[model samples]
Target: MNFHRTEVRHRAVARLRAGAKNADVAREFDIPLGTISYWRHMDRAKRGECPGAHDPKCPRCDGRELDSAAYSYLLALYLGDGHIIQYSAHRVPSLMITCDDAWPGLMNACETAMRKVFPDNSVCRVRKTGCHNVKVYSKHLWCMFPQHGEGKKHERSLVLEPWQQQIVDAHPWQFIRGLIHSDGCRITNWTTRRVGGERKRYEYPRYFFTNTSTDIIQLCTDTLDRVGVEWKPARQKSRKAENISVARKASVALMDQHIGPKY
Candidate 1:
């Protein structure tokens, strides 16, 4: 401990007391982590600080004003294709959403929504073989995303909390948009038809949302019904999964106005 200057120790302790992580303080001050932890413990003891201090950044924990629209959309994204990972070395959990490499706009939208949901945290993008994972770290992820649990999401119950349901109900379109950006697609279907005794080609655009969880599919269909969008359960030809289709011209138009194709 004496190897480090007294001023460095003071600075490290100050940062540690101000809610900075021991690892961050150690790296910033070029001090061993064990020494930093000891110094932090001493500083906390001397100041009579509580050991179990709750973070005020959490809306559920601290009564902060949650961004309902952003949270609703993010909730849909999480339920659709996102996941929260708790690392062994990290006390906080990370929220991650996989975005297709082809849709740069969709990736930007996901990152923006995450930032809006957690303005104080840093968001990062990790590159994969053909996609990018946008992630943000937070201590109260389970509080925010109560739907997170062990095993795949399709296997567990995904009942939304009362507050979360309120947000979704208030911003149904945004929720639908996020879900579409995650696991839904807008495609054009075409077929040949006889018109006026001649062969003619006809094409139509529609939206399809596919998920392995029946609960999530039901949520999507419920929202669609709430918004007066006609939808039907679609059958998969090559896979066993639940899918919802918005094929009616009016419904497609409504979806286009509110939640268009992923970027």
Candidate 2:
């Protein structure tokens, strides 16, 4: 069994030790009654000790210190394309981020961030039709990033804690890079013009970020402002969607200097 399965078993045993009925514990946790009975027997044999106590030496159970850069990147990815889901049957939680297969670097970055957060946990990758789902199994992730909630991000209120905001404030460019790599792109815009009675073409590169969450868009724009990158708000056909455009040559140059393009 994996670490997640072991954690679930330990919790079930803990509840059994707390005077909870075997049937009740099994029902609540969706575990087999036989499994609960076995846990109860083991607990009684062990003098009623709680099995949920994590091993201090096990890094997966004990966790590790958060890396500021990896965490900031993970936070931006969560705000952009990452989500957390809890399994009612097993009572296990998992964090997943789906990135386009074409951009394997972003997917690798997601995996790296997850590993940094939980140094001992395995970061699983599942390939879908066109994207790859990078996932990490741990209930602790939900505790770390409480921003994960129900429904679309735009429909809910998003706020960062003082510590998280401090990280963002300290590394705004990295945060912006993660956000842009997930939900934004850099492309060249071309236009035709008539100069001195002659047809001419002009090409310029710009960065565009679009998202459904107003708070996220605001965060992106605010970070850009902090980095001295000027941006303009663009109209979206749907009221739910918001866009930020950095088309000025100077702004694009600045972004290129800091963020460049995600591979």
Candidate 3:
């Protein structure tokens, strides 16, 4: 489970709690009905309808306390609409973010793609279940912007690609662990060249980086800006005796820019 999945679960739970019917919610949100049911029951338990906490049980043996049938009931409730429940592909995380605006369209695309492949609704349903074992990938991703740029823009829903997973997997702790390392110094004022060729000065501490490429530094800057943190690049020390190429520096700079500055 990653941040995006966590967000999906939370949204699902919230929607269910808001009196949305499981099927309607599932259909509307492109989530399986069983997920809706599970969250709904969990909501009830949270409100104290069930004295015992929900727990994982053995898949085998129905007559016992935590039997398959009992678990199935919970599973069915969570999924709603009698859809068979499957284990989540990964662990669920505590925090997640996703593009809400594009998800519905993506779901429709998935429905169409799946229908094309399976033709029969029953076959599609079966594939939906079995597809759990197969990796279903996202189609595309984009950012959402306010009309005329009046309001804050949010990241548009982007489909995750299988290769994106590899890129993500390449950096194990990029999300959890801070990438840029730097020292902090308090500043009463800052100065930089303005686009209009005038020197502009503002009040803030300047952030510096060492042995970091320009791209990564920019990424650090953008990330900080998003979070309302002020940042600016400082001069880099020359190690030119070793004859570093401009292209190498440029590439490093790009990657670093995306990575952004950090402490």
lDDT of 3: 0.34
Give the whole-model CA lDDT for all candidates, comma-separated.
0.86, 0.82, 0.34
lDDT tens digits, residue span 118-223, model 2:
6756789998999998998775766678788889898998888887898899989889998998899999999999999998999999999999988898889889
Cα RMSDs of all predictions? 7.1, 6.3, 20.6
TM-score, candidate 1, is 0.81
TM-score per prediction, in order, is 0.81, 0.78, 0.21
**TM-score (C-alpha) between model 3 and the true structure:** 0.21
lDDT of 1 by residue, 145-237 (tens): 988989998898988898888898999999999889888999999999999999999999989999988889888888888899999888785
Q: Pick by lDDT: which candidate is best?
A: 1
Which sections of candidate 1 miss by over 4 Å? 1-56
Best by TM-score: 1
Q: What range of 10 consecutive residues in model 3 has the weakest lDDT sum?
A: 139-148
Q: Summing lDDT over every window of 10 consecutive residues in candidate 1, give the lowest-scoring window.
A: 47-56
Question: Higher TM-score: candidate 1 or 3?
Answer: 1
**lDDT-based ranking:** 1, 2, 3
lDDT string for model 3 (1-263, tens) is 21227778788778777777899888887877766787778678668776665432211222222222222122211111111222354322111111123234422333333233222222121223212111122111011100112121122222323432333244322321222211121223445767587777744423233322333334334444443344434444665211111123343344345433331
